[model samples]
Target: MSGGCAVTLDDLTVALRALRLLAVDFPHLPAPDVDVSPVFPEWLRLSLHDTSCESLSAFEQWRTALRIAPEAVDSRTQSGGRTRVLKAEGQFAGAVIVLTAYADEPAADRAPAGQAGGVR
Candidate 1:
């Protein structure tokens, strides 16, 4: 494999591992598969069919896109002062996408408060 392809594969592996961990934390949700392909302009593709129709869906889509195009590192500032960093895999001019998946905060944290009847 080319150097760029190697980087892409590494990125995919990292993202997939992350996703698997996220799945353990959030067992109710289905984690998307990370796909890396040179056919689509050296971009990686992340995809999930069943998920919430709100911001979580959007994040899933973005995460998939970022994983595939791991070279485009971007930061997304979410609510509750949470920040997500999407990192790319290869160098500029020969970068490739790396797709990944993560469970949303709401899905991950089963209980926001330590006691019963706490706010979500």
Candidate 2:
């Protein structure tokens, strides 16, 4: 739906597959934990942006939603890690997706360690 040109799910899928290939070949990409979109090497990010940019917002929403329902997540018996489903109900067409991304720190957004009462 960009500039009156409809971008479809299939187009996004192809772009993702290419990005996956790049990730497999490239190493040490920054975790996709920056704000909403996963951080990647700039070149890779630009490449993905060029590919069906219409759906990026939908992807972010799904990622955030999964994080919300922690209890519903399945962690494969692992400690401190649980997998969740992305319903894709709103914008991603009829795809029920499970996203695989770097896990967030147990308290990444909380107060720094060893500090109390707003004092260092």
Q: Estimate each model's TM-score.
A: 0.26, 0.22
* Regions of model 1 farther than 4 Å from truth: 1-8, 31-46, 50-120
- TM-score attained by model 2: 0.22
Model 2 misplaced regions, further than 4 Å = 1-5, 32-120
lDDT of 1 at 69: 48
Clashes of each: 12, 2
User: Alpha-carbon error at 41 in model 2, in Å?
Assistant: 19
lDDT of 1 by residue, 41-114 (tens): 34444443322334345444554533434335443323342323233343222444343323234344333334
In candidate 2, the residue pairs with backbone N, CA or C atoms under 3 Å apart (3 or more residues apart, or in different chains) clash, namely: 32-38, 32-39
Error of 2 at 30 (Å): 2.1
Candidate 1 Cα lDDT to native: 0.41
Model 2 error, position 93 (Å): 25
Candidate 2 local lDDT, 68-107, one digit each (tens)? 3534433221123221112221112222233333222234
| lDDT at 103, model 2 | 29
